[model samples]
Target: MGSVFCEGLTHAAMYARFRPQVPASLVNYILSFLQEKCKGPMNNAIDVGCGSGQSTRVLSSHFKNVVGFDISEAQVAEANKLEKLANVSYKVNRAEKLPCETQSVQLVNAGQACHWFDLSKFFIEADRVLVPGGVIALYGYQFPMPIWENKTEKLTKLFTDLYLDSLHGYIKKESLDVYYSNYRNLRFRIPFEDYVQIRNETLYAEHQATVADFVGYISSWSSFQNFQTQHGQEAAYDILNTFETKFMNELGVNTSSADTELTLRTNYFLQLGRKPTTTTKRGNSPVEKQTNLTH
Candidate 1:
């Protein structure tokens, strides 16, 4: 698992360059939940696995002090270059052995990167670093929207098959459920108080995008990167071209510059759990048992 995670870090630098549009409504919902549930002011928060710091930047607005940490030095450097906030900083650090002192943080968050963690160790570290009544929130969701045209569907399936074949043990789907279940079983786990579904009410949005934009976004996936690297870039390009041709012919539109509307069905689990007050010391804290979340 450690080796897989390290390999993932190698490509983390590209994450922000292929930025996806996240809904502001979703961000607002999460921040509002934290403000209500957390004990202290949302002044100090830590973002774990903060690749490219997209989510971390959003967190900065709600928290007085926000630090985003990732294992990849390259990723941290890239995040540093893109944006600067008065109260937010980015660092390279391991999630299992966080650099923060005990009981110093008000909130600890992981966005789309919790699946790579050693959960038992991570929860312990989270518990250690959070003050009593400090809230730990974990949220993630699937990429691209659930609604798919036939051409897009074929391309997505082909990409998934290629990636699974390449990485024999990686669990691509169900990542959010896996992390949520892990947190639910922890001794200090707090019940989720709110749930948010950020979806477009209409099939189309006001802003338009071309088919090429859709293709580029899909190609930016980590799985697609592995597929291109292992199977050859020519093959990946061929598959993408075929899908794009199909869309153009059927829809009478070019994807790259078209004004087509796209909607995303993003589901977020906004959970807030308080740190236990009387738990054993950091070193002596009872280890949480591990259960297999992948099937």
Candidate 2:
């Protein structure tokens, strides 16, 4: 099979495995942000790169009509199956070009999936579909929050080095910065504003997972899966085993029944931009609104 085909299969498998583990509270928080920012009932909303529709389900509560689009047909199918609301729908589509009518949507949102989109094209499409004063919200979260534990930190560093060394041309930090900059740049283009990062305070919930769960989450990463396929499963498993041993030793976990309590510290970006209005004559751009919250 072609490399592209193989990558697609790997991604599908990975998404299937991790779809259920996505925290419900996180989804509700994102929806709450949209509700508070957009103000009142959002008549129509679109979720780009919606995956298995966990986020899409949250969106359905706020909008009378909600449509979720993704590049993977398998994901779309899964999302459709999981959607319980009559107003929610799922389709297989790319972020760069949506099938919706121009200037028709009230809110356009990209959840954790924003990192995978082409920012330039996504913004253009967003601008096209949003009505005047409509809102565009892009957000994502980083997991294993503090990552302060010595073993976790070292394993993370090792994973970073492996990816960098294997994918010689890839720059991980620069890639992350793209999403950050994309939201930051919105201030110049539209009525851009954002929230400060907040640390996870509550011991919200805890779950235990085996080595397979770790591998499943890692495989969900397109870059890591591609790297594994190119380098071979033996090479990938070798690294996985090494990291597992280190992680277990540090946590005093038993290999026979290895399980780790996933403690997550989440930082999120709540970027909101308003579609330009005709009456809003050109003037010095308005100052951005920012709020910092902690619990």
Candidate 3:
């Protein structure tokens, strides 16, 4: 991922604090392939471009062991502050260059951060590290939106213009724009596409969010961070502050601490594939266990 996305300690902290997690149902969709593989060391999975471990922790519940990597040291540092799970570990590393031994992993997944990666390199690394028939899942949720009256809709448009206006030249072709524009054709590389079983879907998660939560979430965006950098922080935040005022006025709600616990719905674009295999041995099998394991 880019520096603006997860580089500095401050931005990294905000991202960790506000980013919603990969929904459990979506995680189940990825793990459903290996539902039988529930037990043992053969169920190793990797989460690439894992910023601050929100996605990593969810992956650990299914896989016997999970390794999460990000390019930012500060993001990894922030991720480590989350409650430690027995099966999860995080590190600072690149998505294109994985450290796992060849065919040593049962699954690989990335959440909300693949667009920043070099897809060709990431696919090659995934191919090298995955065991035959191992699964690779990449999924992302769009920005959460509060479902309110007409003012909520109009206010969103107003704030969105400000957000994009601030990001004039900083936009890149390979960033989240690609995901939002045409996720169906999001690029992928060899062996997996040709030989792997691949598919895509949308997943959902529901939350009741406060106005403060919504504002904090918006502040966590990479584009917003870029806006803060290009314009001064005060000028950037002024957009959000203005929106908060509009929100309260239009909705007839109190601005007590800028917290409005309103219902927000979140959904994800999920792209999943499995590596090809010659012989299939279900990992959950009571008797068949692979001797070679890497962590």
Candidate 4:
């Protein structure tokens, strides 16, 4: 947890290419909640741990300005390389200390990246930067389940087994734990009000895949880098290939036919909190003394 495993340029690029774009439906859902609590203009937003700006760019249409922040310079660089939007930018920064001025942001969000943060510090920073009654959203997806025409149940089990059994050890314990829990285990310590948690096992991000696309997506995993570092690329990909073979076989498709089509369906979860409109405290709020450390 001391450093981001996916900070390498190669991994960052792969991530930018393969990671699911934050769905518009999900973004609207978060914004809907924000609108109810904060009646002010949607001036600015911060996308925390925004790898390659997937979540950041999605917020551009919702806010006047949006910035994505990540600890990895490679990630920020990759994000910046994408088709630029005038109101969207990427910065290399930590989640615990956002760069915006206090009370200047209307929404703070992290998609599939909040588990890496020290939530306590992040919450305080989020609270500090958000306007009163602003919203904070943390959302992510579970490992994708393959739906092969009508064999969804079986294919899903196979992919789930591969993830939970073969790749689990390589993944960080905290990350895996949160994923299995659908992020229900995370604590929101910002003293937020009107908290809402959404768990939709039916939600899915559809992707058309080739063998290479499937392999590349798996390779983009942060845990895969750890596995590759320990076992070497050949040894690591061997496992992926073996699973790919099984998956392709399950669909009655030849492994040689790399373009065999199947849809990947993934579940989504969302956690939201709104800062209190009124705090009676005079000075030195809990958010102001986060860790007694500088970002």
Best by TM-score: 4
Q: Report the lDDT tens digits of candidate 2 across residue range 49-120.
A: 888886676767667899999998988987776667999999999998989897688788776676667655
TM-score of 2: 0.69
Worst 10 residues of 2 by lDDT: 286-295
Better of 3 and 4 by TM-score: 4
Regions of model 2 farther than 4 Å from truth = 1-10, 19-40, 146-212, 255-258, 277-295
What would the TM-scores of all predictions be?
0.71, 0.69, 0.82, 0.87
Worst 10 residues of 4 by lDDT: 1-10
- Single out the weakest 10-residue window by summed lDDT for candidate 3: 286-295
lDDT of 4 at 63: 91
**Candidate 2 at 295: error in angstroms?**
43
lDDT of 3: 0.69
Over 4 Å off, model 1: 1-14, 146-208, 254-261, 277-295
- Name the regions of candidate 4 deviating beyond 4 angstroms: 1-9, 186-190, 193-203, 254-257, 279-295
Better candidate number, 1 or 4, judged by lDDT: 4
Put the candidates in lDDT order, highest first: 4, 3, 1, 2
**lDDT of candidate 4 over 167-248, digit per residue (tens):** 8888897678666676777353334544444444444567766545666677788778888899986677677777777777
Q: Per-residue CA lDDT of candidate 1, range 98-163, in tens?
A: 999878888888876676786657876787787665666665554444234545565455534534
Estimate every model's Cα lDDT from 0 to 1: 0.60, 0.59, 0.69, 0.76
What lDDT does candidate 4 reach at residue 176? Answer: 84
Q: Cα lDDT for residue 212, model 2?
A: 48
